[model samples]
Target: MSAYAIARLRPFAEPGEDVFTYIERFQSTLDPFGGRFLVHGGQLDEVEGSWPGYAVVIVFPDRATAHAWYQSDAYQELVPLRTRTIEGEVIIVDGVAEDYDPAGMAVRMRAASAGAV
Candidate 1:
């Protein structure tokens, strides 16, 4: 199954030219690991609860690949630059299978919970 790394970022202040440089470098780091940006920009609309700033979604072949890309030395080096400019949260989640169904998921969840009891 595929996986995604999603980021919700709120910039503390306007990004300077160095921020652009960091972005360019960060993008280049993704290609080798089969990671690509799905969404990278400011919010277009807010239908429900507030979204303070931008959102980004990066797709990877699978969860392991997503973790590898995130923990790689090259990407880690740029972490400070990103943290300094923006306050954000990032998470990785596995994608559902092509044949997934809501009912099936509910059943699975119930089974798992029962097992935990």
Candidate 2:
């Protein structure tokens, strides 16, 4: 199983706080946990619905790994910084694949999501 953490963020009231700095620090903190940053803040050219100010996705080996990272002391400490800098949603999704086809499944998912299938 693969787990993903999806975060949608908004700017905080404090000008001193920012996600870039927090992510930089958090990246180090998460290094020992076997977590990988799949997506961080980048240019957003499309707006289909209510888009957050920032969005991120982190991938982990499993659900336990993702949950442990979130509850870990290191992350717990950094959470306040994230809280100060953003206001939005966070989600953890675990994908269970018995016979996964990375490329084929991804294409199908994209097509389905885009209403092209």
Candidate 3:
């Protein structure tokens, strides 16, 4: 199953040269790690709580690949640039398979725990 790395960014100030530089360099870093951008920038409609600023979502082949891309030196090098410009949260989550069942997770967890006991 595929995984995703999602970033919700709120910029503290207008983008500058360093921000532009990070954006340009960051694009190339994804391909090497089987990662691709799913959502870069688009109109956000907040149905609930207030959310300000931009959001980005990147898809990877799996959770491991997503973690690798994040921990890679190339991506880490650009972190400071982004941090200097914005405040945001990033998270990696597993994608559901085609046969996904919401209730099955609890059953599976119970079975695994019972086995461990």
Candidate 4:
């Protein structure tokens, strides 16, 4: 299945030059893992809720590729810079397949909850 890197970040501290430095070299870390940005932080429409931060989404070929990119040494080295600048959450998530069925899962869940499965 495809995977994604989703992060919601906003400046919590006085951002320094290191944040720019991290951004400058961020792409290099993703190249080896075949990760591409689906969305990079920008001005939000905010039609629903009060969102004062940026939302970033990156797509990878698979969950393993996504995890590998996040865990790579090159990416690891840049972590401190962002940590010092932004405060937010980042997560890797698996994407559903094309033929995914919600009804099937509901049925299965109901069975499991009833101790039938």
Candidate 5:
């Protein structure tokens, strides 16, 4: 399954050298893992509750690849520079298959809940 490394970052101050450096070097970290940016903190039009900051989404070949990229030495080396200027949340999630059905998942969940009772 395809997986994503998503982040919601809010800046503490005006973007500085560290922020620029992180952006410049980000692609190299993803190169070895076959990761690509689907959304790189671009402009967003909000219609819901709230999204107070920039949203970043990087898609990888699979969950394991996503995890590998996150834990790799190259990315870890840039963590400090990224964290120094921005603050927010990051998560990894697998994308659903093309033919996935929510009803089937719900049925399985209900059965599991019933079994637990």
Candidate 6:
């Protein structure tokens, strides 16, 4: 099944200044893992949270791939940079259906939810 790494980060310190150096360094190390940055530091026009902050999401081929990247030496070294700069939550989730069709699943789920035949 395909998987994703999702993170919600809040600047415990300064968003722009505190994290710039380390993130640039970390980005270079991600090359080996096939890590693609889905979202990085960007302006948030809207936030529905107790804490206003930055959100990031990375997509990997599978759960193992995602875990491997995290446990890799490159990421291990760079993780401290994120830890020191941001207060955040990280999660990895398996995308359902292995090859999911969101529109089709939504139709099925809605039918099931509403008891439609």
In candidate 1, which residue pairs get closer than 3 Å at backbone N, Cα or C atoms, i.e. clash?
Answer: none
Q: What's each prediction's TM-score?
A: 0.88, 0.72, 0.85, 0.85, 0.91, 0.70
Model 1 earns a TM-score of 0.88
Candidate 1 local lDDT, 1-117, one digit each (tens): 999999988856779766777798988779888999899985559899988888999999999999999999989988888887788999999999999899988999999999999
Q: Candidate 3 has what TM-score?
A: 0.85
The models' CA-based lDDT, in order, is: 0.89, 0.80, 0.91, 0.90, 0.93, 0.77
Compared with the true structure, what per-residue lDDT tens digits does model 5 show for residues 4-73?
A: 9999998567888998998899999999999999998789888998888899999999999999999999
Better of 2 and 5 by TM-score: 5
lDDT of 3 by residue, 63-115 (tens): 99999999999999999988887889999999999999979999999999999
| Model 2, TM vs. native | 0.72
Give the per-residue lDDT digits (tens) of candidate 6, residues 1-117. 667888888766564653676777776666776778888768776746464777788877789998988888887887776787678898988767656678997898998989965
Q: Which stretches of candidate 6 lie over 4 Å from their true place?
A: 15-18, 45-51, 97-117
The alpha-carbon lDDT assigned to residue 96 of candidate 3 equals 94
Task: Estimate candidate 4's alpha-carbon lDDT, on a 0 to 1 scale.
Answer: 0.90
Worst 10 residues of 1 by lDDT: 11-20
Give the 10-residue window scoring lowest on summed lDDT in candidate 6.
11-20
Rank candidates, lDDT, best first. 5, 3, 4, 1, 2, 6
Runs of candidate 4 exceeding 4 Å displacement: 11-14, 47-50
- For model 1 the local lDDT of residue 97 reads 90
